[model samples]
Target: MHKITIMQMLEKYPELPPISQGTVSKIEKQFRKRGHVRQLKKNPPNKLSDDQKLDVTLMLEENPHTSSCQTTSALNISHSPFSAY
Candidate 1:
């Protein structure tokens, strides 16, 4: 019986998306160790809450020309939601 290598399997499938062989090896290693292929998604630490979102929206509605910096400063938060982009 022949053992199919990562490179050999990748080469066998030509239409697969471009990915480094090293990455595939790491994923295989991670799955073996953790029994999962993907890591848990961590929520952004600086994400705005519903009330904060409403505040920003209301502020914008009051003044369309208001910048994110101005809105964030008025809302008493340091991080700008726009800055994340």
Candidate 2:
């Protein structure tokens, strides 16, 4: 069995737009793993639970002047949990 090189594959398809060797390798790896590569993987987002949301909301209501950094730090969170969602 002959293993085709990335450069060889790229040369075989001149119609393809310019792409990096690393990108080719990633595409080949994805294709081999999933049998196709056109569709992307959609992972579930990381969001706060209902209870966590309530806690944040209540905290904000109690102290409207709290800075973003102070709020996150006080809640023991590294990032702004509500902003991402």
What TM-score do all the candidates reach, one by one? Answer: 0.44, 0.46
Give the per-residue lDDT of model 2 (tens digit) for 12-48: 8878865666776788888899999888869776687
- For model 2, give the 10-residue run with minimal summed lDDT: 1-10
TM-score of 2: 0.46
Tell how far residue 13 is off in model 1, in angstroms: 21
| Candidate 1 residue 60 C-alpha distance from true site, Å | 0.2
Worst 10 residues of 1 by lDDT: 1-10
User: What are the Cα lDDT values of the candidates?
Assistant: 0.74, 0.73
Best by lDDT: 1
